[model samples]
Target: MTAPAAHAAPRIPAPPSAPADALVRLHLSESPYGPSPHALAAAHRAVDDTGTYPDPARTAPAQAVAELLGVRPDQVAVANGSDELVLLTALCLGDRQRPGVTTADTFPGYRICLENVGRGCREVPVDGIDALADAFDDAGVAYVCHPHNPTGGVLDRAAFDLLVERAAATGTPLVVDEAYLDFAPPGTPQVPDYLGTGAPVLGLRTFSKAHGLAGLRVGYAVGRADLVGRLRAVQGSMPFSVNRAAQAAAVAALADRGHLERVRRGNADARERFRADLAARGRRALPSVTNFLAVPVPDAARAERLLERDHGILVRDAGRFGLHGHLRVSVGKAADLARLLDALDIVAPVTGPGPGPALPTAATAQERP
Candidate 1:
């Protein structure tokens, strides 16, 4: 929402590819299963109304989101996607004089958005959450990706509690990007669990992952009424950001709990089978609660190129976002993973933690196009 020069997007590594329909898209953690039929019908119906402007307030989806989370409508703000919320929060949250902070070796969007807004970002290492918590004392805002993107790891209840306490103590805006939260198991500590505690915390949720609405790009935030108000107010700059189809689709998607449950169960089964297949080949992926796995490779950057270039299979090079030596592979359809497994054996082969470096982490961290 500023000058283009200040809002340049991050560069992602892309090799020339076969047509999208022909490629194995295990790169973006998109749902292989499509959206609920009800959602699809709603979106198509919405398309007919495209001649009219979308509801600037995003009413239907916001209320649906609030209901889903058991939060009041005033505490929800639906957006084009959580990415928009990230940029908006980076621009308008907390003490702007102070810089924002997020975990290093995590998502680049937090740093990118903060810097674009002229608010600098401080990054704590992936294993440095305690350090991240302490930094909140002075940070304008803080971000953590629960069931973290590439690693698919979730913070334990104790760690999440400490973060909530720190945010309350310092009054810093703590933003939890829960884009993949739908795939995480039950009892995973999330933003809503701490809302009643009166902490300045927010959770960014999306229909793109488990709900399979990535193409429609609908995401929302739920938190304190005040924080939600600020984000809602900020939407004036892009009032129709959430389009007719996306808003309609998201509401329909949220109502179909059965579809979401099926997706969760399917993904869990696929992820485990994929992990077992890797184990059978003497390769191991880090444990994950989300829908992707961080598979180690001798050289992540090189492996990324070879996978797509040689096999027309796309997997994220974790190094591009600072977590080196791993490929962030989405747990896609069974046939696709089988193909990727076959391809990886040739491209990155099983290189046990050799002399170089122990690949730093068992898990790495996701990104945009």
Candidate 2:
């Protein structure tokens, strides 16, 4: 099929803002800073003790997470990653015969996992959160990405409460992928805030983002004990999923509060700089609380390809999630962001309504982290 022509992205009223290590990646929302020194050291130490199997119950990290969340250990389930949590939630957390629900232009994993588990997925539009909330009574389960992926938008507290109330009334499960929650500003509404309501809400978090453990793939779910128990039951089928190093590192990462704070400050600095760069060049990005900004662009699918092919930079095309004309760029290291700002100026010009140079084919689907 022929690719779409380059076109001008819709502009926001003029505020803007806008990598070279192995590929200058602005994709997959990976953290700019590496893991904390404490976490890294723990992982190294744990690596040396690898002759023994990791605990099948994932006790240590689950206990650590429970303490951190002020929840019981039974309410937390550690897993290989949020991706695994998504799959497990699909497998056992709701009415198996019904379809799962989520927003359009979201992380595709919910739909993928639901379909894979024989529970089809129903996607509502970006502006339709209320609609999605209302539909929950009919759904077996629903997923919401807090500080949402691809778009980075979030619900206000009132909206979040409605979803929870509806889930409580409907007896349907609500899974909130808070994979990016650690990066959200203080007071951002999240699943944890509503856990006391006894709603069937689950928050899937990861050590991948602010903790900088993407490579280690350790994540956890914290929610109602019943939902978490279902996840743990399903998780048991894949024992030893989180390795020794990942668990030890997660425990250590939680210990080093300073490292996490530094990441928060650094991410804020990088995100604003990128936004300023884009604004200076007369472009706009969606407002975001997460570590990535969805920046408007001409033909995101092609811009994504050209950015990488021509500049050795990789960014996600928001078009992949059924949203078009934008790229979801991570708030990566400063130098890398500068490189992308320079590259994007060339690949996606600020002035025209027509498309950029045509490529032969569209970019492929990017995997969720």
Candidate 3:
């Protein structure tokens, strides 16, 4: 026993190669268009003062956001990213011992975050509105991704209203993720509308997607002042409070409505065109309001591999989410979609001989490369 001395365990080795830096990063949904020119300039200005710490109060950015969203500065809590906001909100509302967070099967990373914190996520299969209504009854914290991911289907307004009402009545906090809401078709309710409904709702929006500031990692949550205060307390005094550069850029980006419109229209048109092209190739793409499409294939992995290894194009394999036979492709520039279409044509060849399967075409593929 004396001979058995304590020792450090073996360490795991790193990878052999220089590391695969650009290995088909299509796994994450990201904005293809870069950040606004104004935002970029603001970020540059921020570099000038890197020696000094960012303002702890983060009042200017908060004020700009409040003005933009018709809310008070105290009602907003900015964080490193919307992902951080999601985690903080979850921690504030649900305890590890409790049921914790609830999300649909197809969400991005809510369950992963909750589970990482030794918490549980009550998953509800995302079938339709009825399923969501049935699954969200007084849950610990219900996470709803508006204009849902992967599937890209939006909850009907009536159903959304009912869900919010139910959450309010039950005193359950509903976290509505509007990360892609900026690209939603007109008439969709803004984040404030849900908060104004007297519901315990935390509306999370991010500059990562639409504003093309993913690199800056800026996102904010709006809710009742009390809830926002709770989130801020959970956030503590982080220097990441929307740095001066990101704040300046976010303000300019918000002001530059023209750029937003261009991106929105571009995404919408590309989405329809891509779906149509997939249909022509005997595949189907799920309709989406966000800047991405989910193309269904008989073999998602094969399609993804062919795109990455063969054509040098990247796409997200759905098999990781148990959604085999599908791949999520983000919309980029017109030329980018053209390249994607050409790559898909070469990779996932349509089966059967004559004229291929007859499917309802959503749009013409004349723009397809």
By lDDT, the best candidate is 1
- Candidate 1 has a TM-score of 0.91
Worst 10 residues of 2 by lDDT: 360-369
Candidate 1 lDDT, 228-287, residue by residue in tens: 999999999899999998998888888888889999999989999998898788777767
Q: Return the top candidate by TM-score.
A: 1
Tens digits of lDDT, candidate 3, 165-263: 867776777788888888888877555887767777788888888888888888888887877888888777455565777766666677667778887
Clashes of each: 1, 15, 0
List the global CA lDDT of all models: 0.84, 0.83, 0.69
User: Candidate 1 — which residues are off by over 4 angstroms?
Assistant: 1-21, 351-369
| Superior candidate under lDDT, 1 versus 2 | 1
Estimated TM-score for each candidate: 0.91, 0.89, 0.84
Runs of candidate 2 with Cα error greater than 4 angstroms are 1-21, 352-369
* Residue range 83-171, candidate 2, lDDT tens digits: 99999999998899899999877899999999998999998865556778978978999998877787776677777888899899999
How much does each candidate deviate from the true structure in C-alpha RMSD?
8.2, 12.0, 11.4
